[model samples]
Target: MRYIIVTGTSRGLGEAIATQLLEKGTKLISISRKPNEQLIEKAKYLTIPFDFYSFDLQEIHQIESFMEKIFSNIDVTNVSSIHLINNAGMLAPMKPLERSESEQLIANVHVNLVAPMLLSSAFMKHTKGWNIDKRIINISSGAGQKPYFGWGAYCTTKAGINMLTKCIALEETDKEYPVKVISFAPGVVDTNMQAEIRQTPKEDFIQVERFLTLKENDHLLSPDYVAKAVIELLETNHFDQGGIIRIDEQ
Candidate 1:
């Protein structure tokens, strides 16, 4: 009866996570800009839609209204409910810090960093009234840990996300709440996001050939695999205390 809310479920990693979680038996509340017919057929899924690219998370009011809508949909009387996977994000045509597109830069931070924080906070407030083990896991990237040129906005926002996770972890630990915040890095995968990154201007980004090689070499792990890994990571008791964890390079 664990209620799990996952954002960016329209396709790719988000969709994969939602699907796998459903198969594992959980009450899933999914968020995406568009609905996926396949996800709807899944028994435990309650699909909620939102456009991460267009919606500005800096507009806290908008975020509030959106959360209110979801909260209203939740059957709060239930005894078990808690989990959020803040996975929806954008790479935004990898550009250098200076030459990055202004709109894309802001959108990256808004979706990847700000919105996730807001949604988790809103959910936590809604669920503090419940009895369950609450957990929030952010889908972070390796780009945030090191310099990956052409990954401008993506890197910065993810780095910010890492800090946000730490901040929340500290707060929850101090409050002695059972809630645990996790920031996890999912390594390179064959995703549409990579297609966009490969398109970035040469001067503004990294060499496209290296990316091509990754794709060609079949090094990119399938999204489904990563999703399963997420479930494994969650179950491991390894991070039961909360903090940052990464899906290994495998």
Candidate 2:
């Protein structure tokens, strides 16, 4: 049985991914702020609630606890038998450079960059040289690939994640491990995150109207679409090199 771990399972893209994985007969360990009652009923899985929002990974103590708990819950008997999906993230309260909030930046960096990196490291440490097929799929963004002004902190954290993925993959290759590390952009998904983005002030967002238009015009990809695509990549052995994959490309 495939043991897959996914974060941000309270809703949106994360929940969708978990559902798809469950449907494919993958045993799941889901992490999120809260449980999705409907989704939990739809699939059999395990849930871990971590307050990444409030506790934040910026603090050293919380991270120590978080890392300890992860290893405690996950048993590493056979190597690379698990799939770790770093899907938890947030993009909210968009504002121009001068008006940006420090708390937001801190929170974004904690959730988007620090937590995923630490979690990946912990997983690797526990399962090193197990001689099994495994994967670390970091859910990233197009904003991370390029740029967007008002999304300063969000973009910064995402860009950090992209570079982190490359560095982690390189390290794995240097050590001669077969664990696949993929950094993927799942496209403009219609989720609570999008709704939060839409709430950004008009003058602050460069393409504010365009973003809203896309949402209203039904141009946004459903969370399920991206979720299924991620599952497909995880199931298939196509991404052995740990290259970046986008939703449209998948």
Pick by lDDT: which candidate is best? 2
The window of 10 residues in a row where model 2 has the poorest summed lDDT is 46-55
Tens digits of per-residue lDDT for model 1 on 65-158? 7888877876666636468888888887476778777877777788888898889788778776465677788889887777777777787888
Clash numbers, per candidate: 0, 1
Scanning candidate 1 in windows of ten residues, the lowest lDDT window is 47-56
* CA shift of 83, model 2, Å: 0.7
What are the models' TM-scores?
A: 0.87, 0.88
In candidate 2, what are the lDDT values of residues 1-250, reduced to their tens digit?
Answer: 5678788887899988877766443557777777777667666343422222223444534665676776676546532367889999988548776887788777777888888988888778766776777789999998887778688888888888888888888888866555678898999999998888788778888778888999889999998888888887787866745576678776
Q: Which stretches of candidate 1 lie over 4 Å from their true place?
A: 42-60, 240-242
Candidate 2 matches the true fold with a TM-score of 0.88
Pick by TM-score: which candidate is best?
2
